[model samples]
Target: MTTRNVRFVGGPLDGRVQDLRDHEAVAGRLLKHIHLHDGPKIETQYELHYTPENGWVYFLCGTQP
Candidate 1:
């Protein structure tokens, strides 16, 4: 399947570009990202929003316990 480059904005994933399935690249898509800083169990959720200026922006959805 073809993939598209999606840009992430805000939070820890800011300034990162990731390739996602074409169908999964739509706006309002939520991404669950787990980050292990000093230890495991740290996770964050981000939602994708489309903007003419910034394209797909992943805004922080808050941390999960």
Candidate 2:
């Protein structure tokens, strides 16, 4: 499997680097990322979108309890 190095922008996942598989590297694709807060003990959902220029851009889908 081939993967591309992608950077996440915005929200809690800003500046985070991750690997994007070729199959999942489509434009407008929704990627689910769960961020566990250490202090407040909260979960944040970032529905990242894949773009050709920006890589993955964060989309605030709301928080989970």
Candidate 3:
């Protein structure tokens, strides 16, 4: 399994807490879509965080070993 991290900058979640919530919602949708196609056997390990200083949204996605 491979792991990847995705980062978004200056798109929507720019120093906004509500934007972070929106980002999470979008992430959930993506997870659902992947599960639908790949079945329920895949495991996801990730973290979502927002930083006003950096002005970027980050997603850390990884698979279990």
Best candidate (score: TM-score): 1
- Return the top candidate by lDDT: 1
lDDT for each residue of candidate 1 in 1-65, tens digit (9 for 90 to 100): 98767777677888899887778867888899988778777788999887788766678888888
All predictions: root-mean-square deviation over Cα? Answer: 1.9, 2.9, 11.8
Cα shift from native, residue 18, model 2 (Å): 1.2
lDDT of model 3, residue 11: 24
Q: How does residue 42 of candidate 3 score in lDDT?
A: 47
lDDT of 2 by residue, 1-65 (tens): 98877676555766788787778766566556665556655555656576667665556566666
Stretches of candidate 3 off by over 4 Å are 1-40, 53-58
The TM-score values for the models, in the order shown, are 0.75, 0.57, 0.30
Between which residue pairs do clashes occur in model 3?
none
Ten-residue region with minimum lDDT total, candidate 2: 28-37
**Model 3 lDDT, residue 60, Cα:** 34
Summed backbone clashes in each candidate are 0, 0, 0
